[model samples]
Target: MRTKGMQRSIEDFSRALEQGYAAVYRRNFVSVTYEYMGGYIEEITGYAPEELTPEMWDSLVLHVEQKGELSGLSKEECFRMNRSGQVDRWQADMQIRTRSGQTRWVSDMSTVLRDESGDCFGTLGVLQDITERKDAEKKMADLAETLCLRNREIEADLALAREVQHALVSGQLKQFPLDVMNEKVRANFSHRYIPASTLAGDFFEILPLSEHEVGIFFCDVIGHGVRAALLTTFLRGLIEELVPQGDDPGALLGKINRSLKEVFGQSDSLLFATACYLVLDVSTGMIQFSNAGHPAPLCLQPANQVVAKLESPDQTPEPALGIVEGYAYTTQKYCLTAGEALLLYTDGVFEAYDANNEIYGEERLMAFIKQHLDLASELLMDELLHDVRCFSTSEDFEDDVCLLAVVPTAVA
Candidate 1:
């Protein structure tokens, strides 16, 4: 006679049989028997329900293809668990090769069906296909690994570019941390250079044009980063070559424009650069400078206690170099009396934005210079950069910034 509890358990199993949420299997531990395999079994194992038994499970253990695969589970541990007294349930994720030669992943869950004395009897289990989820996880892991490797390569390349950029332009007298002076010219120079990114497009040089003459040149390529910096390298060599040989600043800039146009003519992309070139003859106190669509440099007259800006000629500001092939550039001259300083910089100086989006325009720059006239040339340059950085709301700059100062040492 069956008790009420046994009847209820049978009823529950009958309900499960009707629902059939996943493929189901049955086994008897003592007899080593497997039976009552549900209809959905063939979708998983590629075999009809009647063909699966304890022997098939045992045969799968010796299958040779599983080595080096990222499959989980040990057949020995599973067999031991089934025989243990304390274990009542089994849940695992497993991989298997189907009879038709395809591989699939499955999640298995089972409950023990014991006898009246609580001795091992058999198991009832359901398995669901999990191959899609597992495959997605694997592809995600591979993509993440590839992205990591690419980022490392980029960082290494930028590091090399930064070092090369420094080496290319450091020979000039204008880089930060060093005071460059010429006794014959009776002038001192100091500068600041900040790249908005890991690489920069801004470059400058102070080359000796002759025994009594020196040229201070600053160039800014149209954009920033590796491409712009590369052009600067080309400009660096060409300017170094041409500035010393020629005394005419405008004519030299014209030569640079032609060369750059020729180099970029065949390509679809547009490339050009703007430069401020100044040739100072210290012995004669004569300064000849050319502006190629660049901001006009400011003059600090300490003797009069006033600020003066080097105004562009009455004509429209000259187009940036490399934009107009036949554009005739004009060189302007100024006499630097004792006790005066000239300031040269890129547009980034005035274009800096504050929290309110107001630019630190020409007016503010002039004011900053006027307020700090007592500062030495180097200190003056530092103060300007500090002001710009502090005024901006963001910690990083949006564009490359370069500042160059040329002051007569005997300025009254």
Candidate 2:
């Protein structure tokens, strides 16, 4: 009486579950017969309990198999494994066609029933509808695939942009030798450019203006990546248009400032850049340079074993480009003796932080140059970059780093 009462209670609980059914099968590993079927069976299959025979169930599964929706171990294989005592339970998701000719997904879970002698007799099982869950998973998979393709396309475009920017900057080492004022002079140029990303805000150009004069321009835009890279290109166009004024550093920067101010005024965005331009005349070893809120260039004198910052006589600070509409920039004169070098760089060089969050400031850079005064322009640039990387916590810079070194030697 107690066992019968527990069985009745179990069936009552199973009937309370939605879209689910319970079944008891009697089989001998060759044929299957149902001893009990209840709880939403008709609602799930659209067939009365007596109408759902073994033949009818096989027909519905065959229809799903023809559509290539049935997957995993077949029912026959599961029965074989159970009869041999290799498996006590099995679960799989499968598709079936309802009486209304609509396909639905179901989760079939079964546990083997053992006879008195430990041989398999039948299975106690449950079937649950899972069509909505399967549909949601498919949609998520499709969205992931689409996003992966778009990310690849964006990476390819950024690579192309990096190549173009590298070509524009001419970051490679270059040398120019000339004869001026009855003296033989050699100008050796070397630089290191490291971008924080595929695109950079730092830019430099070496312009050979005359037989005796060479103009060097370096600038740091306000930010990094695509937006900053675009601004560099715009500045390049402006520089080309003003090449005639390159001989006068003050006049050249003043024109570029006005042009940038005019363009920025037409937009709602606030944008500006820091720049320095210098014209080196090998004939007299004189450099006329103008600054627009940029770090002053350093002069390295190997003969005197000294390193000093170059500054104008008045020592007044000028606003960055585009900051003041009618600001008049002025030129500062500095004489470079034989075996002297000039180091021009963006603020990134001195702004890098160490593990303690301390900046690698201008004083440290000047000290390092004074110690390595005997090294050539190319070797010095390489060593400087190595030292800065070593000082950083991650051994990498967070911003774009650009360094340009020019050494003029009077040849015998």
Candidate 3:
């Protein structure tokens, strides 16, 4: 493997550089003429030294992966380099598929020879076997490509699944009833829902309990992604089936929970869900709501827009549904005057994180509500979501978020 520099004798240099086989290529007009190709010709290209120029080119070019550029030497340029006293030895790698259909990589080094009058005579070259190295290199390249392709396919499939989930998993189901039921013109409502990913574990819906009453329900499953999304879909159907009990928020949640336990309670995965349901009698300014392992809603006054956290009354304390079947859920009542409003939300809002890893905790949420209480429901919602977006480090949240604000119509 020793390499010789100019200081070495020509004999020593030749010995050092000699590798596998030698060949003499003569320039004959427009064609390459191989005057002498030694022992390695058959081993390397399955062609004899006496092979015709056109025949050799046709055979070798067939094996060359890049047929457009099969030449190893530019005879004219080599002669020019030699005449100019420049380093005339040239080295290159070639990709060839042998007659046996096996890929081979070989290194070639050639130097131009000159006649006494400084005219180009021919060229001498040595070809070395580098097939093992080439095979290793190709394998590495192929491995990298395969990995990249697999990753892209998985991401694409997940993206498609996400789109389907968004269409079916949200509270937009059975909307015709919600639209026409919201006829009590003055009840202003605004809400925001953002899933940490393409699909969410959170669900929400507005139901018209009666001609004079409307109900809103917000629910959050334990985790996220496909599993949680599936659970939400199940909950959606449960909500529709339990609409008959919607007049009493507590009764409705209890009924939904019992069905959930029957369906998912036996599973190893934590299938429990936290929920808050509210029914508002628009004409009477009466609002009744129930909570199950969910956050309490905030009640805001009319004139000064004071904020108050309507805590779960100890008398009607109940754990979140699914965890305790047959458990009685106590419904709480709060009277909203003409100018008052209520704010409902999921934990995703308070649990939002900043770059510093700090949670946008409940205290911050309470403060935000208190600060924006005087603003109309829709405006306050916009500002709240904007603030949350800025506070979070990225659009990819770690959880699902849902926020809703409801205000009764003002006195005529």
Pick the lDDT winner. 2
Q: List, residue by residue over 1-412, the lDDT tens digit for candidate 1.
A: 2368855665466347535545766677777776456666677778777787777855543231122222244656565765563467777666777788787777766777778888778887776666788799889999999999998998999889998877766656642213335333366677777887888998888877676677888888988998997888889889867865658888888888888888886667788888988888766678898888888878888768788766556746889988887777888888888888888888777788887888988889889989999888789888888887788855566888888888766423
Give Cα-based local distance difference scores for all models: 0.75, 0.77, 0.69
Summed backbone clashes in each candidate are 2, 0, 0
Clashing pairs in 3: none
Per-residue alpha-carbon lDDT of model 3 for 262-315, expressed as tens digits? 998888877888999988887777878889988888888757757786656664
Give the TM-score (vs. native) of candidate 2: 0.81
Better of 1 and 2 by TM-score: 2
* RMSD, one per candidate, in order: 6.0, 4.8, 6.7
Superposed Cα deviation of residue 385, candidate 3 (Å): 3.1
- By lDDT, the candidates rank as 2, 1, 3
Model 3 — which ten-residue stretch has the worst lDDT? 61-70
Q: What shift in Å separates residue 109 of candidate 1 from its native position after superposition?
A: 6.0
Predicted candidate 2 versus true structure: per-residue lDDT over 1-412, tens digit per residue: 1267746764666666543443332333435555455546676678776677656765776322211222355667654575675677756666888999888776666677776788766666666776788678778889988989988988899899999888776743376643435645468787888898889999988877887788888899988998899889989889878877799998899999999988876778778889999998877789999999998889988889998877787677788998989889998898887777899999888788887999988888888888999998878888888888788856667888899988887522
**Candidate No. with top TM-score:** 2
